[model samples]
Target: MFITIEGIEGCGKSTLMEKLANSLRSAGRTVIMAREPGGTSLGDRLRAIFLDSTLRIEPWAEAMLVNTSRAQLLKEVIRPALERREDIVCDRFTDSTIAYQGYGRGLALGPLEQLCDLATAGLRPDLTLFLDISVAFSRARVVGRANRQDRMDSQSDAYHERVREGYRSIAQGNPQRVKTLDGSLGASELLQAALVEISVATQ
Candidate 1:
């Protein structure tokens, strides 16, 4: 099973992924945990470039770079894990591209989806967990936890708001595959909800 956890920055995706992976491991399931933009060596280089606030890039250029990194990651990491029949948990995936580039950057989503489809050759997660949170709450979490912000994190509040909307749209459009979770809950509560969803989906 390929499961992706997605949301805006500081939405607790990473934390929840870790908890979920541990839970699955304790259940005797083979699990592979990974993250986008840096799952492979080449992808890591692209991740550095994409996340660095120092470099100014056009929206299209940024989109292209993210897709390129994804192409490499899918081939080198994601596909291989799935082939082994390992349960895969990913921090982010194509949804992030749609949210960050298509919505946040005001770019056309059709072309972006097309590019990603070609990159992954039609591969997609079996279940996508959308950790829903407001842009203000997400930003506050980031500010309180970290001293430094990435290029994407440093984006304007308006951009993050658009990204949050994008995530909502995706979840609404794919209700059967995307499960939207209210992330304002306590960590244990969130994990329990996610595990219940995963169990139902897999069954």
Candidate 2:
């Protein structure tokens, strides 16, 4: 199974992804946890450049960089793991490009979608968990983080709002594959809800 978690910065995706991976492992499944703009040597290098807050990357340049990472990740990590019958839990995936660049960066959505298709070679997640949160909550969470903020984290509230709405639109368009979860819920509650969604989808 391929599962991708999608949300804006500070929406608790990494936390939830960790719990989800552990839950699946406890259930006797061999799980491979991965993150976008990463998951391979080349991907990691690209990730550093892509996420560096100091770099002023153009919208198209950002799109190309992430897809380069995605393509490498799929070729080097994701596909081979699936071939071994292991479950893959990813922190972010193609939908992120659509939301971040297409919506937040004011790029054309149609081409972005096509670019994602080309990058992934038409591969789509079996299930997606969208953690829904307010723009204010997202900002608050990002502000409270102890680690260095990335490029996406440094974007304006208006940009994040557009990205959040883009996620909503993506969920609405792909309801069967995208499950919306309340980001405001307690961690344990959110994990249970996500497990339930995965259970039903995999059945």
Candidate 3:
């Protein structure tokens, strides 16, 4: 099973992913946890270039860099895990490229999706968990937690709003595979809800 957790910045995706992986491990499932844009060494270098707020790159360039990192990560880590039939939990996936570049930057989704599909070699998560949270709340959380913001996190409010809406659109289009969760809830509650969703999806 390949599960991905996605949302806007500071939407508790990492926290929830950790909790879910821990629970699955306790239940005797061998889980492999990874994150996009930096899952492998080559991906990490690409991530640095992509996320450096001071570096100004073209939107299309940014999108392609992410795809490059994704391609390396998928080839080195994700595909191998899936081949071993390991249960994988990822922090973000291709949906992030669609939201961040396609919606946030007003780029072309058609090309972005096509690039991502090629990069990932048609790998898609069995289930995607969208942590639904307001843009304002997400920004506040991110600002309070991070001393310095990344390029995406440093974007304007409108960009973040578009990203949030992009996530919603993706969830709506794939209701059977994407589960939306309220990110405002407490950690334990969110974990419970996610576990329920995972159980149902796997069953």
Candidate 4:
């Protein structure tokens, strides 16, 4: 199963993903942890360019680069592991393109979705956990971080607000497959919720 974690910046996708991966590993499931625009040799280079704040990338161009990385990662890492019956935990996937490029960057959703389908060869997550959080709170978490801001993280609060709304809309549109979670919850609660949801879905 391809399980993805999605959200606006600093919504705890990465941190929670680590714990999720650990939990899955403890259960003796073969797991592959994939970070999008990464998890492959070509993707590593693309990630550097994609996340460089100094680079000015048009929305369409940004989407293309991201999908390119995704295509490579899927080919090199995700697909191979899945063939081995490994459960893949992806940090981000197609939904990020829809939210960031479509809503936040003002691209047409229909065309972008089509483009995504082409990029991914129609691969979809079996279960998606969307970490829902307020734009203000999510932005503050990004600002408070010691790490340098990436291009996406450095986006305007207004832009992030649109992205956040886009994620909610996606979750609403696909409630059965995409579970919306309150990102503001404590770590224990979040983990418990995740475990329960995963259990129900995978069972």
TM-score of 3: 0.97
Instruction: Please give the CA lDDT of all the candidate structures.
Output: 0.91, 0.94, 0.90, 0.91
| Model 4 misplacement above 4 A | none
Q: Could you tell me every candidate's TM-score relative to the true structure?
A: 0.97, 0.98, 0.97, 0.97
The local distance difference test score of model 1 is 0.91
Q: Backbone clash tally for model 4?
A: 0
The residue-by-residue lDDT of candidate 1 on 61-163, one tens digit each, is 9888878888998888888888999999999999998988999998999998998898789898999999999988987899997567888889999999999
Q: For model 3, give the 10-residue run with minimal summed lDDT.
A: 146-155
Q: What lDDT is obtained when candidate 2 is compared to the true structure? A: 0.94
What candidate 1 gets wrong by more than 4 Å, as runs, is: none
- Clash pairs for candidate 4: none
Q: After superposition, how far is residue 180 of candidate 1 from its true place, in Å?
A: 0.4
TM-score of 1: 0.97
Quote the RMSD, in angstroms, for model 2.
0.8
Q: Relative to the unseen true structure, what is the Cα RMSD of model 4? A: 0.9
**lDDT digits (tens) for residues 149-176 of candidate 3:** 8887888888899999999999999999
- Tell me how candidate 3 scores on lDDT: 0.90
Please name the candidate that would achieve the greatest TM-score relative to the true structure: 2
